[model samples]
Target chain A: MSITREEVLKMAELARLEFSEEELDGFTAQFQGILDYIEQLRQVDVEGVEPTSHVSLSADFDPRMFREDEARESLPVEEALGGAPDPAAGHFRVPKVL
Target chain B: MSLRRIEEADPALGAFLTCDPGRVLERAERVDRDVKERPLPLAGVPVAVKDNICTRGLRTTCGSRMLEQYVPPYSATAIERLEAAGAVVVGKVNCDEFAMGSSTENSALQVTRNPYDLDRVPGGSSGGSAVAVAAGMAALALGSETGGSVRQPASFCNVVGLKPTYGRISRYGLVAFASSLDCIAPLGNSPRDIALLLGRIAGRDPLDSTSAPAPVPDYVAELDRPPGRLRLGVPKEYFGQGLDPEVKAAVEAGIRNAGKLGCDVVEVSLPHTRFAIADYYIIAPAEASSNLARYDGVKYGFRAEAPEDLMDMYRRTRTLGFGPEVRRRIMIGTYALSSGYYDAYYGRAMKVRTLIRRDYERAFEKVDALLGPVSPTAAFRIGEKASDPLSMYLSDIYTVTANLAGIPAVSVPCGFTAGGLPIGMQILGNLFQELPLLRLAQAYIREFPVAPPPLRV
Candidate 1:
């Protein structure tokens, strides 16, 4: 399966990442190689095989495994916001979204 | 003693991304003081932490420029447990950026070389954790594994590493690479130390609902139990093409040693083994893409300096924050999970994962545990596979299957190459069978103790 520069760009956009021209070329080639390598998975006869999203789910579902949703002690808002790169009045300050 | 070693050798070895001697000493003193009131199991033991696991107030960089200064607000459950059990935190060690690569060379922060051979790569993303334990900088270290992060490095560094059964340890604050496959593992000089660390950390935690509700066994005590007439399976697929001759020989010797310990060793086939890499690459990256989407410039971590709007900021910030390998994985994951391609890649890989898991299940039905090589080869020279991403991914060929299967596996030092690089034999157990695996490893180590590498540090 041949990958196109446009597809790479679309992936970049979807991933919320940007690549320089040089880095993009390198990444595209490496990506193609990886894609080719992973293409081997297509050969497996997966008909009727149950897809495992996570190993924990492989077991019968148990509602008791989940913690009580009741509110408990949590990090203070100050601590929660402490790592934010841009913080303002009780919120993370980001650039204009609209 | 660990502090002194760190002071003496860490400068040259680059094993730590953050080692504050004063802070470590203070914690050690506190441990000493607290022991007077009540005895702690790990009293005064110095421990190194991988940068990916959160240590509140300490920068958990995940070896990425994105989180270079991002100190977590809370500690991971493993870290909290270790500290509660009287272990002192030595420092945060380096890892592949966001624990994404097979070698520490992907670390954007610093380079951690193999203590065995400085010119060679420390099998990573847990390279620094392995280095810290191997070089005597710490008695124990916490390393996280998505693929071969812990076991591969343990093999390279000649330290004992354990990737416990999935959910054996809580992932409350471990910086997620792939949520489905991620595990917080332990590294130490001996199987006993690993057992001690594992015992302290493995248990049900309310913070992480995925942590198994099963009771945590006394792993240290389990090590003393004799492994009598255990059925040890040697996976035929693990010994196939691409396995280095030296590594193969060493693992063969390890299998023989197990037989000498009264084990009924038999060759077993994990038929879906070859598909593990492709399945893992797809599944892990797909999960990583979603997990990492939270790293937008808004809340935490690095943000682009200037942007016209939010989208531009998100794009530029991630571009600048994440290193190449991280970017590559994110892109792959994005593509795999994207619409139209989902079933072909992510969906199919998940089914292949079931086949892989079933292979282990079937093997375990006949054998108590499986023995194999932890890595295809020992430490390679730095930059040897840096430019070739595919080659680097292949280094994890033997290791990723355990993660995919969600089984407990350990890396035990077996023998060394003629050139003196370390080789490790991997012992994998059925779900929550860490006890038998540790016992078998301890028994093997007792029988054939491999000499440590000549300490260049």
Candidate 2:
């Protein structure tokens, strides 16, 4: 019915995240609150009503999609790094590892 | 200079986390030179882009340290179009990290304050964009909506936010939140401005495969069309429980204002509104967790220093990089997708999602358009729900269904709470019905434009 700390741990494992002690305590309470709110749905009789997915129910026309199958524009190496915080001759530079 | 004004003002205003003052001013000058003889429509307009959009020369942080220094190599298609239309990029505005929350309060970078009241929060994801435009820092802004990111913030900030029907605007360069549910939209101080900007941006794009081939309607001209037979639907679900009395009253007043302009208002029930939030959590996260898997510090983003192995690098980088909300959704998504839980979670949610769409279908048959509150409450104080995640997620209750349905929706300033904080009434049109929605919003603005949003320090 509601999210449990165990559920949070299970979720964290599935998500591959490691939480701090503070975070674990904080999120458990938070996620539980959301689950409780969603439980409000259980009160409504949505059994017979068709569930709504999109604002528009029409499923008529689908757009025609196609691509040239070619790389149209490839920026030169210099232009590619123009936005990088730190850039070398042709590539982005990161902090030294070894 | 105007550039300094935004940075200087936005810091306290919380509109911009990073202001590219030098670049924005320089780019404005380039617009002058590059477009001298032939003036572009948006020539010289300084615009703020939500951090989630990738701008080629600026760091595309998406309000997270995960992309703290990641400057995208190429411009997002929307940004490219805006620049081509002669708008200079002022800088990136802060947002809910990865646009996962309703209140911009979720952004780890900096929370954008509502221009109306400094202590109150701006609505999320596109909060900074709305604040930037509302505060006069920029004439226009770019925001994306998976749910209410664009519209809700625009309501809080009293700007106009337009989320075109899915694929009305190219999604080629937006950082993905929920792919099927997301869109790059426009925000402006007024409905007319939204129409003008939409004219320049909406259309088929070769790069975005999802873009519809339908001719991009001339939004500006369409704004003037008279409302002769406009049948607007008022969904009872949106105006119900948890909605502040002041906000509900304001929305009804807004409907009356629209009625005065010859728009016919009718009550329509989106019967499955009850199941939307539950359905959204399942579907959106399932999509997002999969989309975000690329950020494992392997291909092109921040990587953490780990003890030896590749798993260590992936684990440490993701653990350190993403914020709590981002991690939460990713986990919810992953669990829903895991082998054992896939059918119960992801599969069932997909069925519900389909049913939710059907609810809208049935409603639209009785009404031409739908109206509702963009958000349940007016702007809340900073940290109001920061500690309570469920309450925060509920903040998007009114706005999420449209995303699930993939329809065009817009949030325009309708009225204000007693405290003068703006409340927006949302307009949802059938898929690809952006032109009519803009027209209706414009009509409402013409009849009763809320007073300019207060600019508090």
Most lDDT-accurate candidate:
1
What is candidate 2's lDDT per residue for A1-98, written digit by digit as tens? 56677777777766667777777877777666655554444454445454333322335435357777896767777765554444665776554456
Every prediction's TM-score for the first chain? Answer: 0.89, 0.51
lDDT of 1: 0.91
Clashes of 2: 11
Please list all clashing residue pairs in model 1, or write none if there are none.
Answer: none
**How many angstroms is residue B333 displaced in model 1 relative to the true structure, after the best TM-score fit?**
0.5
Judged by TM-score, which candidate is best?
A: 1
TM-score of chain B of each: 0.99, 0.97
Instruction: Write the residue-wise lDDT of candidate 1 on B65-122 in tens digits.
Output: 9999898999999999999999999999999999999889999999998888889988
Model 1's i-RMS, to one decimal, reads 1.4
Cα deviation at B77, candidate 2, in Å, is 0.5
Q: What does candidate 2's lDDT look like per residue over B363-445, in tens digits?
A: 88888788888888998999888877767777888888888888888898888887888889888988788888888887778
Q: Compute DockQ for each candidate against the true complex.
A: 0.81, 0.31
Over 4 Å off, model 2 = A1-11, A20-29, A32-63, A71-98
Report the lDDT of model 1 for residue B416.
93
lDDT of 2: 0.79
